[model samples]
Target: MTTSAMETAVEVEQRYGFDLIDLETVRYGLIEIAREMNDTLTRGSFSPLARDIRDCTSAVHMRTENGWEMLASHEGCVQHAFTSPHIVNFTMSEWDESTLREGDVILVNDPWRGAIHFSDLNVLQPIFVDGRLEFVLHSTSHVADLGGPIPGGFANGAQTTFEEQLKIPPTLLYAGGVAVRPVFNHLLENNRTPNLLLGDVRALAGSLSVGASRLNSLFERYGLGHVRASGEYAMDLAEAAMRRGIATVPDGDYVITDSLDEDAIVAEEITLQMTLKVRGDSMEIDYSGSSRQPAGNVGTAWIESTRAIIGTKFILDPASPVNSGTLRPIEALLPPGSIVCVLPPSSCSSHTETGSRVVNMMTQALSEAMGARGIACDTGTSGVAVIGGVDERPGHEGSPWGSFAVPGGGWGGTWTSDGVSACIVSIAANCRSAVNEHVERESPLVIWEHELMPDSAGAGMHRGGAGAIFTIGAVSTTVITITGDRSRSGAPGSSGGGRGMPFYGWLLRGDGSGSTLDPRRAIGAEPLFGVFDENGEPDPDKGTFGLGTTYMGGKVSQLVLQPGDGIRLIVGGGGGWGDPLERDTERVLTDIDDGLVSESFAHAAYGVVLDASGAVDEDATAMRRRDLARLRDQNKWSVPTACPPAWNTATIMEVAS
Candidate 1:
């Protein structure tokens, strides 16, 4: 190159350095800001998901030619942020820079315009340096009631997106450096929990301001040019790290397939298939043969699934930087209208419930292709939250209000160890249910019992994690809504591991009346019913199916508990690892004493002979394992069909058992 051009290039790099650091600093700063913003909403608002469950995300982005580059804070959520580029392009085309003044903001909850769902409100503010757009600060949070046909806005049977709730596109809610009262008033007037919605919106807007302020400060310290350069540097580092990580896996072609129980809304079973081709240091994920997206179904996009699996791997190995560069060697082929590439205007409310199943299927397929190397299926699914309304204080105005709660589920078992019990897994790992004490304080409900269910995990050489049980009572007459999945079936096991228990929910009455609640059903009623539990031996006496239970009302009072009204919740367990016969006898004995694994299960599943004192018969256990191994080898089933030619004993055991 010419001397002048070379000099210019060097200057550009130095200037971009400050911009890069500023970008990254602002990215992390947004996370802390988001937490504080959420805290303010929880303390100031009335929504159960916001104040109690905490389902929200906040982020910042740097403007790029295609759109905004997701700079930081994809941790709070995975769905919306992945589609942020689309949102940015649409917004800029629709609104001019002159329209976005300092203190001005834009608001949208339109799924078509790049939102996960209507319940999640996305707020964006333009950050300017010297009156030119430099970055965008954004936040998204789940509002309990959005003036929907259903109190919680999760209308399961709604045929159209409009029936689900309102759709707000990129409207200039606040302009000319002022709060737009008309827009705020319209939102409040349309919702049951006006105060709560307003509070959440404010919280979202506040987070954006915080991010903008942090960006401005960074700009002053290092200059915008250097900040931009740092982003490029970070991307380069991330790419290098990801390439190195991919090199660890053996180079070859591996394919895996998984399916959904049924598209609840569509009432049809769907398949999600994936093929991973790793050649040297490069990898490509092909989703060509996946099922097509049904009309009006929104859960078919493969990008989210691709990001989720890749993101999970990145999380497991943080030494790998997260950026498009890390994804450079990775390519995805999602057919149009496939489950992974749903057409616009499709119902995607069930995306999380079904998307999780897709992730498991991919993991399962990968495990199969890789011969179970560096992978394991997590608890099949993250349990759903059941929420509704309750009536207390007969003489009081607005005596009825909404409430909700989520139950935990089992983690997946691994080749080396059992799954962790009652832990949320995969993409939704950070989500948590409401604390019992807090639930009682905020709503007219009483928590009866919240404990781990015994022996619910799959039994094998490495046992899975245990599920949970929670019972609650309504202080007064109330109504509630329920939404979630993984109740009908549990996650599948690997090798010789057993399947984790399925999840369930039911309703119990004071008069000894009870009924089964469909996992896909969303209903409203006084004295609502809810349950969150994994599958296990059924109880004929109480008529408990072992999934979950929730009750809305049994009495009438003002946020006070009365006798005879309650709800029950149960979480599921993870799958086990290896054949039970291969489990250590001493380990089985210790499990029996610790109440993790029952003596009967130890004896039956693992072939461990335990005496009355909980001591193991080592000779018998050894003989049983030897016999089992011999049988496996004799049948030519001791190794996986896809095992490499250089496979070893451990590899054989992992693939076979």
Candidate 2:
């Protein structure tokens, strides 16, 4: 390289506030590298979780003086885009990047360090150019198993680091393009499903290598000097845009707090609070009042726990790209020993449901800032059900056939449209439910029904999405574990909107006598507002479906079952945006026809009266709406009260024949 060229690169780096060249092409090329890496991982992985559900992400970064600057990331989870680069920076310091070599891959899953959880493994590869490592490629995937308390790593009872799952700290998984036998063997011996993990690791490694190859070509084309300059330019562009987005939120200190639905293990509901301070072009989120870290694995990783905080800026400016620049205008404050920032021995494995609550409450607090853009929260649980049993096939490998499903729930409502049903929540980005056909083909479990729960959405001007019900029939005796939430404090609505129905989980017992149970007994005829009991009063017990040998503990751990037995898991619904009475009468009639909203709900929540013919009663609906408007004028929405469990008036539950 020429001395003049080196001097030019240094000068460009020093004046790092804006682009010195045409950075648009540089940005496009970086994005292409990220997308290519994503394609490789999605195509190469074995598990339905990584390949089909897309619970993975990849990124390419430029090493900066202080940390790695995110050039681009795959169009996957937005949270990963913001947090993964910082993780890469953390890894650099932890392992001392100067010793990294070509073809060597670094693996990290220490939650206290930078990983979101133990299950989300990260594979890092150093990209060396001209005998110098200038950039790095990263790939993160939610591997199927890591030998936790359950088949899936949703170990609800994991109270300490030792119980959660295998935690692989920063280590050399590969050296000089060869697999480290001892490290690989250790992973295989510990994990129950080693084959799947091996495939996933291979996929991650391949993606990293591919990203390096692509980035190398970019270096050859643009030269290392221009390439580094371009990255700095792109970061500056994104930072400027992020600051502008922050400026729009109106300078003020907005504070809000919400409680997690209590489980048997944590008898008392834990509270998470966020105080967002928006001033000028930057924002600060103080989580000072959050509950202390729990004995269970419900704690969060401190390094990148601001998916909610950063997500809000994106929520306000949907067009902004997620890069190093986008993260510049915000600071997150999670004190040590708090729920959002845990220390050693504090479990972070069973963190998805808990993390979702953090994201939801943050979104709720910011709703006042961007009222229309502040959409309601989704069914915040991953709705995991891990099933395993002996595979007694003639040539079985002496191990049980096991497969798990992280079922997606409903997404919250927005000002312009109703919520999305049966999907992974907003924070998850592009992830969704793994195909059922693939699940049945891979294991002995057969899904009889996977459908939307009728009238399960929170009622509002733009009604929230309805939840889903999964009924799986096991062909043989098996052991199952469920790690989920939202049954306790079902998704809450806002601005006078009605809350969604709580979730339900049941086991058929398959007693052979063939008498079946009512599937929808928990929901009333008017299911929009709340769940009800058999007689007619509202029911508030989140564990009504915890009978018949099922587990309803903190994380809903293990239960042994028999052939012909069916497992029923009801995923919760999303929260609504505004008052249901403000909803259009025509839209309510349409919902009635579509079976999403019941006639009773139409009358009670939306103030839309339907005639005997199932058509809208225009005059009656008008009068009902007028009365609701009058109530609103009389300040009826401000009064709040305590409630208890009651019965459902609607007999929506179907008795099996």
Candidate 3:
């Protein structure tokens, strides 16, 4: 802060009879408190999305005159940073500070009311001092299952929200310092995996208690008023810092348009457009021209996911603390009834499929504005694959088990380094992939292989990251759902670069011979209701007769398999950054030796040929590079008709139960 601004802040502190220096220390203390809550939740949760995917967030907030303002948050997911405060805003009218009790906790998961989706439930506690409310602690986590036909909450195809699952408003899960038994029991009775999810709820409540305890200690030591003001000061600093960053960028209206691979509900494409207006020290993202509510579970009514996408654009660092100030300057024009902001009663269970695509689309646009600071497109699919069956994995004879896996693809290249391989996309901040050993132990399946694909990364001066291929076999009858895209088109590159290879996979027979089954007849794990005629139903007569076989890409419904049937999943690579022929010949040879790129592909894509001994043939390489450049100019190497990297993402999903 400037000297004059500091004096003004001091004057405000004096007026309130609080010490500014004390408030500063209290700021750091609040941050530690949030961290404690995050650790508690991570260690205490049971579901893979929570423990493995890290699909959760924690924050402490102070309500201001305008609305709830974020004070400190867990330094984790970018999508969670600026969106937590908005969650409080969504429930403000329903319940205010005066209405909350000292020990009462409220729960909400309705997507229209500040949640990412129906699967993610949030637990909130109002912090009080001397019988007066001062701060509120909020925690959110993605649970594996809710009461429904599907194992997880992602019902890929359903006409209305009623079919999605249970929809709880901002109601008190706890009343007057006691756990509400009726609410708890109701949830348990509704879900298939009650034992696993109950533990998740308890963990969320535990995190709230932990955060409250640590925050109370800070208030007891520094006085609640001073601590609150310190939070205010911290937000002020964050807003100022963000303004400075905005001022550094050139002011202009930067617009970019893109689309998803296909709507899993039907054979249609979905579009997402972003027009960023950078003013003196502010930004406005206008999604005015995007596609409206199409028929499917592809889009959602949740704005939290949109805000998270905007938040990721502002702060690239994964560990930065995101308060309300980080999003204070951006004005969004998300037209109601649009894909991201769908109307209520539309199934948004798997909204992340399309929401993640928005994150990639915006990132591509930002990279054009600021080359050094921006990143390229991502393997935009959530890569959702659901496998479920009776537990035959030893010791458990007939218990049913279901597993959800989002096999991550390669990341797009950036100015600083090559895109990362087999990592979660930008929106899934700090999420961990499921381990092969764990998958084997939990379900009746064996993870055969998990290795990076060769010649997968987009060829460039600095290549994009390589994706991976995984194969799994069922020990018994298993059902599979494939919600994927990019089978035909791959992650597109930029700056005269080329796209990476698209996804490819198949279902193989048990005998280890040539494949014997074809999944072409499958309606997908989660097929849009055969109700195109308003029948709203699945027709077994037309559905797959249990042929769980190979699928190149696109959505497929419940593909069934006999014992020994297995799947081979290949994830796509990230988009390249620059011209492939411009890449260094030595790097190309080194990539070959490391098994990242094939020698044939290296020579074909990068004009870098090797001699008989496998070293770079400089003279021949120079000639080849010139010839490649000439061909590129002639549109021979250009993807004149190829989809843009941000376009045609496999944002589609199919639910298999």
Candidate 4:
């Protein structure tokens, strides 16, 4: 209360407020750069995945307590600076330069050397303001073809890391503000889509240049000291925000376990377990008892996996800043060589699978601790990319092209709402499936159907989102490969919600006959392959097959559709929230009208008894629910299974048996 104390307090508030504003402004500048980078890639990239599928990420970095701090507004990719800060630091250290030249750019894609994989190309450029390293701009993208054993670089059976794709370390991609033509040429020559790669790389460079220019402008407007101080302020603000969010949840220890359908490379299922111990305003997640790494280097490390889970939580709650400071409250322990913490020489091309499971497990655990405050589980996995060879057209030069198609699946229903249908889940949030029209025109394939699979979502008070079904067929002789999860088991639901549908793949023959395909299998010269419906139905057939899998050969109809063969893709639905009977009548009616929920579902699940006129009989519904409640109480209702099975369990059991 003294004058001196009051004066000190006023000065602190004023300084902090000023720094906070400056920090936000700088963060926006960085975001602008990231957006530009994304746009540049979308516009310039020649590959279907980059231009159409949009599988890429961009970020800006400044020095911080954790080595390099990721600026707000950047989409964090699996192995980029956002998820792997240590990798960025390692790259920067290897460069060993305090001051960076104006035109300097570095490219790296070595998973063993701070990069995610050879499929993902990373380009980093340091922004120097007045001859000092001020900021780092980086971008990452999933190139359609990277000259790997497989067309899409997702070699599920890849025995060695070298077979995955071209590996690059901390190589100088650009020096003195000029493109390294030799290096660029080397990369282009090794890939199937040279024109696309070259264009996308330039786009990345352009994005970095824009970010550097922005940083310089900010420095010119505000002193360098202020800019640097602002970066620190951003971290401080994020730390404070995260602490506040954590403090809201009651402190306690909670644990949950989940598993991968199976390791794609090795045909064994693996579990990911976590015990979250939350103290006053901090928490730690331990994966000590989780499954160890696969026999080979085929998974991700525990620390990185844990970081990814934490990253998902942070992203969902943006109020909590995403940085090392926010992660201070979280700790993870995984035995070395465990699936969660694989050591070197391990093939980690599929590390994202473990990371996704970790996210699901962590979220499930936190939901148990905090009840309804947690979001529902997403559709368990992002179905893998099915890349194959391009069929040749007579007049058009034959070249290889592929589709990075994503199957849709169920999302976990939340406390207040149903899950989003037909969407990719957490790990690849920014990537999307290519449109059929564009895909077929560019590649030698025919897309059959892209429709929603009804009743595939788990039922509850609020039903989960619906899954999707898509089909495609080879127009010529081509090779195909698939890499993803959720074929063995479906995504689990929460509370009283029903489990979502599982994913499946198959190959269809010319005579309406079909054979099941393993989710991880790579095939050559297949006529037709696609996702199946919940009832195991294939998309309407289209086109005809030719010899040798090439659409161009005789009796092949040039591999172009004579109109009856195709590939199909099906996405899963999200889970529902709460008990169906507990859902409000109005909400149930709304869902019925929206075509998301069926009339039978409304009555069976929500207990909303309806008359012949499709009108809800309030009194009848109330009476039905009362009886259901009595039955539930008699059975000691508590777990999600307290209610009747959501799907036709009898039929499913009979089929399986």
Per-candidate TM-scores read 0.80, 0.89, 0.87, 0.83
Model 4 scores a TM of 0.83
Give each model's whole-structure lDDT: 0.56, 0.71, 0.69, 0.60
How close to the true structure is residue 227 of candidate 1, measured as C-alpha lDDT? 57
Q: Rank the candidates by lDDT, best first.
A: 2, 3, 4, 1
After superposing candidate 4 on the true structure, give the runs of residues whose Cα lies further than 4 Å from its correct spot. Answer: 1-23, 76-81, 98-100, 295-298, 302-307, 310-316, 319-328, 512-564, 599-604, 607-609, 617-657
Ranking by TM-score: 2, 3, 4, 1
- Per-residue lDDT, model 4, residue 143, is 77
lDDT score, candidate 4, position 240 = 60
Per-residue lDDT value at 370 in model 3: 73
Number of the candidate with higher lDDT, 2 or 4: 2
Off by over 4 Å in 3: 1-24, 96-99, 308-320, 371-373, 514-553, 639-657
lDDT of 1 at 386: 44
Query: Is 1 or 3 the stronger prediction by lDDT?
Result: 3
Residues 318-383 of candidate 1: C-alpha lDDT, one tens digit per residue? 554243344445566767667776766666654565556656765665556555553345555545
lDDT tens digits, residue span 283-330, model 3: 887888889886777776756335534534444433335677666766
Query: How high a TM-score does candidate 3 get?
Result: 0.87
| Candidate scoring better on TM-score of 2 and 4 | 2
TM-score-superior candidate, 1 or 3: 3
